[model samples]
Target: MPSTPAIVVTDLVVDRGKKPVLRSVSTEISAGTVTGLLGPSGSGKTTFIRSIVGTQKVKSGTVQVLGHPAGTKPLRRRVAYVTQDASIYRDLSVKANVAYFAALYGRSRHEAMQAIEGVGMGDHADKLAGNLSGGQKTRTSLACALVIEPEVLVLDEPTVGLDPVIREELWDRFRALAAGGATLLVSSHVMDEADRCDRLLLLRDGVFIADDTPADLRAATGTANLEAAFLHLIRALEGVN
Candidate 1:
């Protein structure tokens, strides 16, 4: 992984109508690396992602992307966020949707088609996005994000509803993106996906339980896998041996 910090969060605190969502979270994600945000549902994973992308408001702390404040104009094209919900135009064809996003970035139709192919949605390019299956729609959404060639990419539960094959394909694409020097932060509740990442940030109850490499996390917890390590960490936090 590159030594430079691509994204930085310092003592972040987020609240949703008086209920704490993220509690003093802090971390530095390196450039040109794929970092997994692993956590259970309602563990502040999505909230933390929004904070990094500069969409969610925070009660305290600071989040910076590429040395500037998150969500600022300078980082607009440099950062791309793909939420769990596919944010494409349902009425538009897959190609049209992706091309429209490419247009926004002043990219050409060729680039739009290239992005669609990059996500393995080339065969379904002409299909209406609304008629696509869950996995297809997710890939279509990813194509839109890839059009910008962002420096930092954030994905919130991108593989949650995908099948095994599609999930594996997406992970491969993620690895390729990182290899090209883009910093990627992908969130997933599935423990099996943990090994696909270069580093992991484990969140629980609005705070980080652990932050380390997959192998190191397993070794530290004396577990055989990430799921077991997660459970062991939780039990230890609850004063269980």
Candidate 2:
């Protein structure tokens, strides 16, 4: 039998508050690759991420992760998710939070501290999560996710509002994780960040506009950059109609 994809979504349809958010979406994320989910606000990027993470109830379709259905008990420890909002404990120190979450994954304190240092948060490891800056808290949450050494890592807007240096650093870490045989699904609207991913899943209006490598997307759209490529594809589709 063929091995399963890292993540597979087949004919996924989701509705929130009785209003459809995703419409018949389907895709396969390859293992040990970085797939960037790109789109405008409210383009169903978050919904798609949630669907694969097993946090969103789908209207139809199936989402499978590592050969098992998404949100299954077996996946709880294998999949790591970092939302746009920092889910760190306000009262806990960064190290404390990372260590606590690590324990839940049956990881050691050394692994927790290594993750904290990976995110450049070691200097502030003892600071209260609430006291850290927004970007710092986000990094702390990222550290918590990394401590578990998950098979699949899902990150949403992980580089928002951070310095360019920090963004580069994080992207390096992501590449390293992918190199280590982890599947990474990262969502970011920032066009520049698209270049860092192995593949880009360009979503628009609850559908995939383009699903290809960043280079292929640029070449096919005849654009020099990802943002221009997005507009180019949309306009080409409009012209087709």
Candidate 3:
């Protein structure tokens, strides 16, 4: 049986200056499942993700996380969010950065090492962040997010600049985390990664066009691949409007 939704958004609306970013967006993300927010570069994926994480200002809507309103004080330690921007102590070693963040969450240093190892950074843990490669830095950022053992993790374009091998390894780790009952909301514009998600939320221009499992997406569109499936959805939506 399926569990309750980890997050839910209803009639979500977000406006930036004079422009409206999201338009009546609504969706329920299943707990303990990996749900990919798949879209193009300017499709409001980041904005929607920020909304879910309770950082983006909403014009009107409700975002509920774990049965409580988003941004509530109680959820501060329960939700871990990692943005695309790689911000860490350049002078600090990878291990130190992770351990420090864990301490901020009231977690022990041992848990920090486990998180560093989870992101495949145990060997490079002692390496200075300033000297690590871009991919390694990204891994360090992810390890920091894992320190709190959060129930919900929201990552924005985590694999964007990573190499194929590192991307594959991170995806495997994401699956492992989900299997352990952690809900992950990973945003990516890369269509190739769509099929890896347990479920997908297809977004374009701040609106959801389709929400279904990858297999269902393929079968409904009668397409052999995810790219083709997304195209079919776009055309179908175009015809309706």
Measured by lDDT, the strongest candidate is: 1
lDDT of each: 0.95, 0.92, 0.92
Model 2 quality (TM-score): 0.96
lDDT of 1 by residue, 1-241 (tens): 5889999999999999989999999999999999999998999999999999999999999999999999999998899999999999999999999999999999999999999999999999999999999999999999999999999999999998788999999999999999999999999999999999999999999999998999999999999999999999999999998
lDDT of 1 at 130: 94
Once superposed on the true structure, which residue ranges of model 2 sit more than 4 Å away at CA? 1-4
Lowest lDDT sum, 10 consecutive residues, model 3, at 232-241
Can you rank all candidates by TM-score, best first?
1, 3, 2
Please report the TM-score between candidate 1 and the true structure.
0.99
Listed per model in order, the count of residue pairs whose N, CA or C atoms clash below 3 Å is: 0, 0, 0
